[model samples]
Target chain A: MTSISIIGTGKMGSAIAEVAARAGADIQIIRRRAGAGSSLERGDAEYGLVGDQLTGELVVLAVPYEAYPSVLGHYRDRLDGKIVIDISNPIDFTTYDELLVPADSSTAVELSQALPAGARVVKAFNVNLGDTLSTGTNGTTTTTVLFAGDDPAAKIAVADLIEAAGLRAVDAGPLSRARELEAMGFLQIVLAAIGKTRYESGFALLQ
Target chain B: MTSISIIGTGKMGSAIAEVAARAGADIQIIRRRAGAGSSLERGDAEYGLVGDQLTGELVVLAVPYEAYPSVLGHYRDRLDGKIVIDISNPIDFTTYDELLVPADSSTAVELSQALPAGARVVKAFNVNLGDTLSTGTNGTTTTTVLFAGDDPAAKIAVADLIEAAGLRAVDAGPLSRARELEAMGFLQIVLAAIGKTRYESGFALLQ
Candidate 1:
């Protein structure tokens, strides 16, 4: 069984936890500083504090893009030899007019650069809404998770996790392709925020 | 019956012609110069020369973004009282690294400003691949055409045209929202180019 550690207890974090638990992975919910030890109401997953040793090989940073710096600072070299998933769409929330990251790079790429060399960064779940991820469906269509990274093994692991949860997973090429995924995610969020589309569903990649 | 004059016989133009013809719209195919006047081999669209007057009220600029200047200059003041559909994704095709227009504006907005005040500019079809539009399906799912414009009447006309062709048309908010649609379209094209996804299939907006 693949062990997973998801940081942040926001909507995205909770949604991913629901799916990961459904996939029967050993789940660890890390909420920045920690909360009620193990809340069975959310999921039957282990809850950890900031200072706790990162146990799961697959660690997901489900926090907002702004939290990466602090999270990485605390974890630092501890993230070595782990599969770090970056699911943040680094868009400006204040004006919703621009993205915070460099035009050429994505949050995932930036996260990878900050993490230890041994940490494999995979870009996934950034393109999905929290509601869609939790429901595992975009209306009648099964939620399709698009992921990208340089490591084949890391991509396979994340794909397996998503697929095991009764969702669809797609490999969107190298980590550089995260730029396109970020664009798609940003567009979806903007549409939802403006009431042009629904947050419960998003742009589905139908086969 | 609505008449559509498509400028450029490229894949996108031809694909749109197929749908518009099926929709029972009178089609007028206008190449850069002239064609074998009304070739029935390529749908029943009437072929016309550059000097010919646009008979269709719905003028589709199916040409590449680069040709917009010349096309607009040629028919500058002539597009009055017409509904012009701008389907060009203004991306730098040479490297696919950047979009050609300003970050705050879209090609449709630019076209709207360049044309006569009476002419209504609608942004549509830039989000779809020619093959998907031609087949009216993105694999098992029907192709959903996303359109945006300030004029509700123009949107209704385009929506009616799309629905008549057995495809889905979605209103993606005001003309300013074309930025998001362009981003989506650009992502799809880049994915196809990198073999991450198929050209015949695209991001389906499944309800």
Candidate 2:
């Protein structure tokens, strides 16, 4: 049984927990406040929140892009030998036109640089909408989950989580691909405006 | 009956034609070839191999981003006093990570400057995907179409067409909003790799 812990229990955080729980993973959640959808009976899901930090195989950071630095800083010490999945898309909500991160670098790439020397931070789940995360298939349209990271092992672990959620996992090359993946959200915004597609609306990768 | 001419016959151009034809509009398609989907013989719809050199009340430029200058050059003379709709997003496909258009200006702005003083250029429909453009509603979800223009009258005309296509026309403010709307496609590209969202995605502007 793979033990998994999810930080941030908002819509996406809760949805991930619900799906992971249903999939029979030892799901644990940590939130700012103690509530119904809470994962653990302790403090936050940071590294120091638990006695052991690097015990779990995977840690899904479902927090906002703005809070990434603080989250990483608080948990960096304990993230060694574990996969850190960054699912936040650094969008400048103020303008909604410009990306907050530098043009040359993506939020995921920046996070990788900030993490511990051996800590693996993979980009995943930033593209999918929280509303449409369904474990069951909707006809022939199987959901596509994209992930990217320098560490192959970490990428595989994250991919397994996506597969466990009943969606197909696609390895979208290296960490640089995160830039493209992050920009991909713009497409969803367009489709979402027309009510023709859903946040969970995904594409079939044709080579 | 409003006389509308589509300046390109690509996937997006054809999809718009299909919607326009279904909505009982007089559509003139300007394409290089006449084919099955061509509306040449419909009598209601006209087919012209020539570009938008001579235009009517509405002229939709559905050409690729790079072909904008040539298209504008070809049609600039006839575009005077006409309502020109720009549906092109300046996407740098070569460098998937970067935007080709300068940070200060957008493609729509460039086109606006290129057009005659009398011609009204409105930026609309660039964010919509050809795949999700169906005549009917997707169950209870209503389609939201976005439009932006310096001229209110031009915006209204484009909005009217959007409504005829079974979607709600939203005024995304002034022509500068085109920059935000154009950047939206790049964001969509990022989401596509993740395969969790669709091309027609957009956000609702609420009070």
Candidate 3:
């Protein structure tokens, strides 16, 4: 079974943990402090300290875009040679209309730049909503988990986890393509806010 | 039948004319010169000069993002009280990695600002690829035509045209949401370049 470590205990983080746990993966939820009640209530997962040794091969950074630097700083030493997944959409919350990142860059690319040399950053789950992640489907269609990474092996590993969780995994090419993925995610959020899809919709690439 | 006028005779413009023709709309194709052989070969569309008097209630600016200023400049006097649809995606073609428009604005919003006071600019068909617009489907699934405009009546008119073309019409709220739609279109183009969807795929908002 693929072991997974999820950082952050927000709705998205908890939802990812739930899905990963349901997929029979050995799940560990990492919080800033063990006493924090924000950790998910899933029985298959155990809460761990952020600075401790991460037992899972895959570590998912499910925190908001702003918290990335602090979280990465706190766990910098432990993240070397680990496969890190970035699911944060760098949206400008003030207006909720535009992306907060640079016009040519993405949250995943920025995170990848700040990571330790060996940390392989893969962009995933940013496109999938928390509701879809928890339920694994949007209405009659299965939710698609689009991921992008520089490492082929790392992308395959992430794809394996997504497939295990009863979702379709789409490889969206190199890590540079994270910009596009994040843009799509931003669009979906705006669409939801505007009552186009009611926040219940997930993006599907029609064949 | 909903009468429609299409500006420009490129792939996108021609495809829109074809779809409109297929849907039984009274289609008129506008070219810089009436003798230009580049106009759509469809038997249903009547060819006309760009500076000529347009008869359709709805006019589609299917030109490139760069040509918007010139096209709108020449037709600025004639566009008063007309429903103008902006289908241009302001993508930075040099890099094909980022949008050329301002971060907070969109092509439609920019064009609206440049149009005559009474010309209602609606953002539609910018998210749909030319292939999907031509065929009206990515596979068995109908392609979604997401549109946004500040005017309620204008959006409904554009939606009617989209539905008449046998595609799904999704109202994505006011004109401000065009930024998101254009961003989504840029992402789709990038996805195609990266071989994620092969340019044959269209985005669908699955419930």
lDDT, model 1 = 0.84
- Model 1 alpha-carbon drift over 4 Å, by segment: A33-43, A91-104, A113-119, A193-200, B36-44, B80-82, B90-106, B109-120, B150-153, B193-198
Please give the DockQ score of every candidate, comma-separated.
0.42, 0.10, 0.51
* Interface root-mean-square deviation, each candidate: 2.9, 9.3, 2.9
> TM per model?
0.82, 0.70, 0.85
| Model 2 lDDT per residue over A174-205, tens place | 88767666755544454455554544453332
The top-ranked prediction according to DockQ is 3
lDDT (Cα, tens digit) per residue for candidate 3, span B36-75: 6454677778888877778788999988889877887678
DockQ, Cα level, model 1: 0.42
How much is the lDDT of residue A131 in candidate 3? 88
lDDT of all predictions, in order shown? 0.84, 0.66, 0.82
Better of 1 and 2 by lDDT: 1
lDDT of 2: 0.66
Model 1 chain A scores worst on lDDT over the 10 consecutive residues at A34-43
Off by over 4 Å in 3: A18-24, A32-39, A92-94, A138-140, A164-166, A193-195, A198-200, B18-25, B33-39, B92-95, B102-104, B138-140, B164-166, B193-195, B198-200
Model 1 interface root-mean-square deviation: 2.9
Question: What local lDDT score does residue B180 receive in model 3, on the 0 to 100 scale?
Answer: 74
